[model samples]
Target chain A: MAKIQIIVICTNLIFLAFIARLIIKAKLREEYAIVWLLITVLLALFSFWRKGLDVVSKLFGVYEPANFVFTGFIFFILIYLLHLSIVNSKLQKSITKLTQELALLKEQLKETNKSKIN
Target chain B: MATQLLIIIPCFNEEDSIVSLLNELNQMVVPNTFIITVAVINDCSNDNTSVIAEKFSVVVINLPVNLGIGGAMQTGYKYAWENNFDVAVQMDGDGQHPPAELNKLLQCWHNTQANVVIGSRFLVNQGFQSSLLRRWGISYFHWLNKFFTGIHIYDSTSGFRLFDRKAIELAVQYYPDEYPEPESIVFFAKSGLSIHETPVIMKERQGGKSSIRHFYQLYYIIKVSIAMFFSFIRK
Candidate 1:
């Protein structure tokens, strides 16, 4: 294997090991850890099979394999960002609902206390 | 059945204008209404807005953190939905939306039985016309909305609006986090909800700067246009 390919594979393996540690330590949820593990594995696979990216790029009519890799990385990042935004939006909605309910419940409790005292 | 109306005024540091606006609302009576309650969603205002709002008969929902106008308004809608309010009206707390014109919206709601009734300034060209740049921005969105949804809402950016039970229910579930007014019109129309626009005069804001400044006008236009485009494509 080429020195650069070996380096890439080693980096990917290190990242995979780090993610596994996080998963084992319960720092990252299993669902997200699975996604990270899959990405790392794919990176290691591509690094081991250096010609695989060129083959896929050629099949997809991409002239430059490096450009294809960058584009794919960017596309994945955008999808992940979009997913995070959706989750953030859902959490925002639920938080707003909870705050409203808490405010109303506080008001009700105040009214009840006042009536009881009267 | 007599309509139970909840007027939701989303205020953020409007210390100068809120008191007088609340007083104006206090005196004005909407005819043919069963119960009228004014509530203020104090969006974590740094000023004494909450104290002033509480001085009146208004119910104040003091948010622990700032949620901007859209989130604050959604809280009010959720309150209306849970409290069994037949209708909810969104009026700005900056004293721009005239309380006297509220009856016109209620009347439109009664007559058309529409899911949402919007108070439009461009319909009759009455009251405080916005700046030239702002008006141009509004016209762009107006045209974009027509092109996208085939619906003509002259003032899609107007916050003065009346929402019926169905509309309130929908908004309570989900509302755009920011710049929601224009996007909401397109959303409601696409969702098969009936929307009616009534001509009403609006005054210039009494105090505090507008969230969208002159420098941000271009950015606002681009952001809202992109947001509308996404809403159009999204299922």
Candidate 2:
């Protein structure tokens, strides 16, 4: 019923719709979109249940509900960033392997062509 | 029995010294039983490095994209593996690693049968000992590497190294992408490969700038330190 709760509810609703549009347009893959959707839905659930955040924070032994929300979101972001770095490292290894293989194959092809001429 | 020795020269933009280095290598004498083959991995140099190397009778692999020294060296190792080379020696294209002293590495390998042989400038306490600041950095890595792997490498950053078939296979499987020298020593030691160090004189680079610059000293130290740690813990 409070103005802040209504604002939070409206913001999360808009975010959910935006994510749905992205998924529908094939702009976001399902694996990644799942995380975003989970975040938005969690925020929406807390906004709809007025005492939800306060109860959760108290259960987690945090003195302030707002501090808990900030810390929780930051923790999520850090985890996601770590996942991204792992993926990036794998991609880099693959690219290096591919480049090496391509160069080797090209050299082999040249040798084959040279021998054919002789 | 003939030993297939493949010398891997990973070059960047070393047009000034590539020709002379190749000539020196060609002129170097090895034992009768060893058949030496030189393979230069040009790391997408903008200069005429690949062009000049192509004129020689060596294998020249030109990577389309610049994949730093680690990637370039890995390419050479991959080639060595595929071609069934018995031993692979890595030397700089800048002519710092003297071809005349290659016997020291071969002799060490012959006597000790080490899986990997490193040519250390600091072993004899002589010859082109880098600047005071660089020496300090090398010493730091020496101690750090010793602490982690329980193996002491006097010149851990030396590019002059020889890898036998087992070492070459390991290199092809996984190699550090950037700043790999010191970190790789630790990795090889941890992987149960026997490593031996021999004294070899290194000359000041004939041409081309050193890869490690003054501005990037801190970054290099931090990156290598982190890489060493990760390599230690890697399964």
Candidate 3:
């Protein structure tokens, strides 16, 4: 194997270990950690089995395997960003609901206090 | 049960226009059979809008953060739903929605028994048309709504609307958070709710800049169209 491939494999393995530790420590939910774990595993595989990526890219009629990898990376980033946005939208809706409820409750409390003073 | 009406006015930095609008609303005559109240949603305005709104004896919901018109109006709907209001009406805080025509909207709502009643400017074109560019945009959405939802709404962008209890409930549960007016029409129609429009003349806004400006018009059109498309495709 080339020196660069050795370095890539070691880096991917370290990343996988770090994410595994995060999952075990309960710092990340398994549902989300699975995606990161899978990504790290794929990177390790690509580094060790460099010919595998080329073969797959050739089978898919991609002219350049590096282009395929970059495209795949961009596609995954887009999907991940979309997922984050969906989660954000749900959080925003809930926060708005909470704020509205709090305002109404405060008003009711003020009104009640006024009547008692009267 | 007697009808309980809640008028929801969403204000965003409308310190210049809110007081006069509130005064106009206070003087408007509502029917004796119905109980009426006003709720001003102060959408985290950086001005004295909330203080002025409170002076009018209206319920002021001071939002902790600014949630544009859609979020602000949804807060109003949630309030109406929780308070057991029978009907809810939305009017702009910029004094463009004439309080005198509010009675007309309620009449239409009562007569048609529709789930939602909108005060339309193009129904008879009573000489309060918007700018030429805005008119063209409104016309495009009018056609798009008719084609997609099969419901012809002359003024889909008009914020002056009265909602029945069912409509209020639905809106509280699910409402668009941005550019809600036109997209909401599609949502209501797709959900099998009846919508009726009545002729009402709109006045030019007295103060505050429009939320949808000239530069953002394209973005507004594209976003609303995509939202409407998704509403159609969703179950």
Error at B216, model 3, angstroms: 1.4
State residue B227's C-alpha deviation in candidate 3, in Å.
Answer: 1.9
Candidate that scores best on TM-score: 2
Please, what are the lDDT tens digits per residue for candidate 1 over residues B186-210? 8888888999999999999999989
Q: By DockQ, is 1 or 2 better?
A: 2
lDDT of 1 at B144: 95
* Candidate number with greatest DockQ: 2
TM-score of the second chain for every model: 0.98, 0.99, 0.98
Better model by lDDT: candidate 1 vs candidate 3: 3
What is the per-residue lDDT of model 3 for residues B100-121, given as tens digits with 9 covering 90 to 100?
9998998998799999999999
Error of 2 at B59 (Å): 1.3
Docking class of 3: medium
DockQ of every candidate: 0.36, 0.73, 0.51
Ranking by lDDT: 2, 3, 1
- Output the worst ten-in-a-row residue range by lDDT, candidate 2 chain B: B210-219
Q: Encode model 2's per-residue lDDT on B1-235: one tens digit a residue.
A: 8999999999999999988899999899989879999999999999999999999999999999999999999999999999999999999999999899898999999999999999999989878999999999999999999998998898999999999999999999989889999999989999999999999999999999988898888789999999999899988
- Per-prediction backbone clash count: 0, 0, 0
